[model samples]
Target: MPNDFLSPADQAAAEQQQRLLAAQVVRHDQLPTTIRTVAGVDVAYAQHSDQLVAAAVLLDAATLEIRHTAVVRLGAAFPYIPGLFSFRELPPIQQALAQLPEAPDLVICDGQGLAHPRRFGLACHLGVATGLPTIGCAKTRLVGSYHALGHPRGSTAELVLDGEVVGQALRTQPGINPLFVSIGHRVSLATACHWVLRCAPTYRQPETTRAADHLVNQELHRLLAAALPPAPDGM
Candidate 1:
């Protein structure tokens, strides 16, 4: 994608190494109860460059079996802005999504959704762009506050926006940090939390998303190592 495609306001922030828009809501909905395939998306950055890498891995929602994987590498023009994370990450994510051989019944993004300040985060942006049902499953809270829930992994608390409930904070593993689950587009916060807990076997993060995070980071490190020249001073 070209930098010109990014909004002029967003582009101005990019040039200064700053970001605009903490968050905003784009869209959302509920997915089919009997979901077949779920895709996990994650991004990793190069050691010292504007290069951003994204990977999408599809898996059987029920069996937790991997089906297909896609990857994208692109120059990241957006800065490390807290609220405007989607703007920085969405381009690479879109590329990876486009390369997927098969469309997934659902997509889970490693970021925020309605849980964000602007209500639109990485997951929401991508969901709107692809017109796919997506869920934002973040390892930590992006905005808002929540009362602690039951100790069990399935316990949850509503995420409110302007006095209206928009998402949830779910405890995926008992005694572990809860995940901020929110509707991206075409999904519900309740169903988002339900699927997240169901997909997690024993970790705080769901298997699919955890695996995707690892995969992208691995590729990132691999590329960085490849770019390094062998020791030339001696050996």
Candidate 2:
């Protein structure tokens, strides 16, 4: 699929379609206090193509060991438009999740949640689609302003939206870049922070997300390697 194929009217229709999907997205209640399993999803793109390879890694919360992994390739129809990333990413993520042995207790995504303008980022998309508890642990803020967090592990500042506290900017490692943590669905901001920290053993990123990111890069490079290369004689 190419953007050139979408007329101005078609683009408008696509945006409207996304809005309709967002309206149907389900929001869950608070999550269970103890999360025995957690999964993370990340995506990588094939250079110069409207294609993305997404990876999902599920891990046991206690042992922090991966129990399952799945991958899917998506021909992105939705543009990389702000506030509508779920439209571009979630379809393939859902496919990847379907291949898992068992659904995870919770999910974490590398994007926003309620912090989004439409309040339906990648984590929310997956949460709604799977009816599972989920949290958004993004590497950067999307739609809110917040004060700088303290230079200590576990220090956090509130991510406020329209004068309401929506999430937190958490410092998982002292003096390192902080992460934006928000409740996707079936969880609270507090629980989101707790689980994210628990999953962050020795890095700024959670182990689950880090593992998923690794898988994305790994699988993407593997696919690239399997493709034909230029002839040595430059024929």
Candidate 3:
């Protein structure tokens, strides 16, 4: 069966879809005090093509050990558009998540959350769909501003959008790039940043993202290899 939601027929339909999902997106403090499991979602695109690979990595939050990993390769069902990236990537991502053995307690997404212009990023979409505690931990600035934060492991600055604080620029590690943390669904900004820091005891990026990126790269390599045509017999 085809995923109709992925490919919006027109701009009006895409806007309407975002409005509908935005209505369902929850932004609050509904987080678990003790996180036993955590998952991260990421996507990689093939060069000059719509082909994409989405990967999900589950980990034991307490020990940061691998629990399960799932990956899916497919041509992106939707076109790429700013502020509507979820539509392009969520199909494969959802497929990968469905392949997971079990759902994780928390989902850490590699994109914006409530910080988006529409307040509905990939994390928000995924969270509403799965009804899981999800947080967006983006690596770059999407739409926000902040003062220079201190060069400390725990320092943070507010990420403002539309004259309101939508996320936080958190320094999980000293002297490295900070992460943009925001509420996705069923989670608060404070709790999200806290978990992000805990998940990044060593590196700047959280363990969940690191693990997911590694797995996604592995899957991407396998997919590219499979897609490559056979060499000539003379070789």
Give the root-mean-square deviation of each candidate in angstroms: 3.8, 4.2, 2.0
CA lDDT, candidate 1, residue 223:
83
TM-score per candidate, in order?
Answer: 0.87, 0.87, 0.93
Best candidate (score: TM-score): 3
Which of the two, 1 or 2, has more lDDT?
A: 2
Specify the poorest-scoring 10-residue window by lDDT in model 3. Answer: 1-10
Clashing residue pair totals per candidate (backbone < 3 A) = 14, 0, 0
Off by over 4 Å in 2: 1-29, 230-235
lDDT of 3 by residue, 1-235 (tens): 4577767887678778888888887778886777889998899987776888889999999999998999888887677787888888888888888899998899999998988888888899889878899999999978979999999998999999889999999999899888999999999899899889999999989999998898888888887778789767894
**Model 2, span 1-235: residue lDDT tens:** 3232222245466556545545644444566667788998988888677778888899999999999999988787666777767767777777788788888888988899777765667776677667788899999889889997899899999999899877799999989999999878877788889889989979999999899999988988877777758458754
Q: How would you encode candidate 1's per-residue C-alpha lDDT over 1-235 as one tens digit per residue?
A: 3544453465445433222322333344556667899989889986578899899899998898888888888887667778778777888887787788988889888988777766667777777667788888998887887887889878888877778676788888887878889888788776777778878878888887887888889889888888888657764
Q: Which ten residues in a row are the worst by lDDT in model 2?
A: 1-10
The most accurate candidate by lDDT is 3
- Extract clashing residue pairs from model 2: none
What's the lDDT of the predicted structure labeled candidate 3? 0.88
Provide the global lDDT of candidate 2 against the true structure.
0.81
